[model samples]
Target: MSEVREYIAHARSVVIKIGSSALTDLADGLDKARLDRLADAIEARMRAGSDVIVVSSGAIGAGIAPLGLKKRPTDLATKQAAASVGQLALAHAWGTSFARYDRTVGQVLLTADDISNRAHHANAQRTLDRLRSLGAVAVVNENDTVATNEIRFGDNDRLAALVAHLAGADALVLLSDVDGLYDGDPRKVSETGERARFIPEVSGPEDLDGVIAGSGGALGTGGMASKLAAARLSADAGVPVLLASAEQAGQALADASVGTVFAARPERLSARKFWVRHAADARGQIVLDDGAVAAVSRRRRSLLAAGVVGVEGRFSDGDVVELVDTTGRIHARGVVAFDSDDISSMMGAHSEELPADLARPVIHADDLVPL
Candidate 1:
């Protein structure tokens, strides 16, 4: 059940993310041959009755030569300008490539707000669902054209994982230039002439101990670190993720031994809870004492004000806030029961000693999502 082949065989829906270096060239822009091959792999999966969505990167790279830039733009406005020009080329390249297999592709651009906002997340989910039902493949990408530095998803790796959550994908395949996760630097041969050991399976987040992070490719923004982060996010939500090379996409989808696979978590989260865990932008933080941490993490109890030691940031009642430990590790997120100022005065008081209206748990378990 932990094997990638087994998972792919039963995966009815998938999100396939292609990294930039796999497709773009600074001198020539989008690589048509490579894109067509990717489309073929996607088409094969679609033909197998699996709904497929592509979270693509390469917009910035594609703009390099066409706009006569020697390298990637560094400034914000220039970067957005590049993305504005490149998005059209990226979308057309995908559309034309997929057309060879008679597949219809629809572009769906998104920003962080699209998922972080509850109402918007539902709208995005429904749009993807409709596209799948109509046999149209979704070509998803970050809307870099208008995204600001503060609001953008820095790389497509995390974006792909979020898209998997939004689409309820059973499997996520992240394609890069590297073969897969390795115990050491795959490029550096050992003293015994052995290459880095390729890790075929990671059962949980803790298993990622010895894996080294690689730098982004010349035309890409993500490295091994980002891909692993993406895998963890999707796996946490019960969707297995495959980390493989772009060359092995078809084989990977067919369940061949081609990449490292992250096992899906045993706990499947509800859609809203998943959103709260990953998408919600916390307006504030509530620092919990050891006793409160034990009560919430172990006892699964609501957060009473008696355990609150500190509060940071100004936020209103009902806003989402992070629940952190004394060491600042975020353990949960929940809708607060009272304003930050009100909660500050109520800290350390016994529940029964507080005013009747404030005698409740500061955050109810029903509204809390563990991180």
Candidate 2:
């Protein structure tokens, strides 16, 4: 409990995420009392001199009952329609509740593409920073109405992590229906079930080996898997995360370990590197020779053509590609300097042998990001 409290006490800026299950009822349009409870808790935090940003997930759920739908919509069109209608109501309810504390709320809707694009990412960071600086709590959500399959955030859990990274938040709190990550499903009630445990440290991916995956409530898309993924991502960026039940939200923020606490690391990656390493999809692989590997891994230099061994997949220049070693393990990712066709021709060639106009390294070391 002190561990959880110590974590929250140290966080100067926080990103608090409330899932649909926390803010809505099965048949109600929106749970106003629950929203007020959450708002009041956040207001207390703000009064304590901490900056808070709320990444809320309930637009579609809020619209479901109001639109006379029995359950969450199945198709994307209806989901988008629901989001369009529900977002206004969601913002209104939040605003009304926040007013009790004399706190202003600002809305920020983002799509996955917005963060993936460098320019848009900068714009988002600037906007959120300004809003927080002005003493307003930024209520963020995915722009579900305008997002397509290609542009969707998929889950708000991931969005919260991304927002924490974007906002340079001190910590991230993910409020869900469940208490926290369990060794196995607590519902199993087995003789050896570790129903509740605090994850104080995450050394690597193996730390998440025995975690369980489960679905969300009828109105949400993010489940335990997405929340864990968010934990890993945000933790990697040096932002600690608290995963707790919505029922215990106030306690969760009060230093109570109501859920699993993922400790943040000290060597956090830069925002660009974090987004590049985790968020971007690699379009191809560039296998490097030993010399290039040493240059990159040891000297932190851009990949030179003399170190190229092979190229895989169809990729255009400026697209993200994986840098692999002889063992076929990805060591880094970066924007490729040449198209796949050009790289194929340039492989195994000396710098002078390449055309003068194409003399640059295959993937400059400065642009490369180690995985």
Strongest candidate by TM-score: 1
Worst 10 residues of 2 by lDDT: 193-202
* Per-residue lDDT over 1-371 for candidate 1, one digit per residue giving the tens place of the 0 to 100 score: 45655876569999999999888888888898998888888888788888999999999888887999988888888888888888999999998888887778899999988988889899999999999998888999999888888887768999999999899888899998988999788889989998888888899656878677776777888899889888898888888888999988788877646788888888778887887788877899999999998887777789999999999999998789999999999888988989999999999999889999999999999888876
Model 1: lDDT of residue 295 = 80
* Pairs of colliding residues, candidate 1: none
Query: Which stretches of candidate 1 lie above 4 Å from their native place?
Result: 1-4, 190-194
Residue 289 of model 2, lDDT score = 90
Q: For model 1, where is the 10-residue window of minimal lDDT?
A: 1-10
What TM-score does prediction 1 earn?
A: 0.95
Candidate 2 local lDDT, 61-87, one digit each (tens)? 998888899989989999999999899
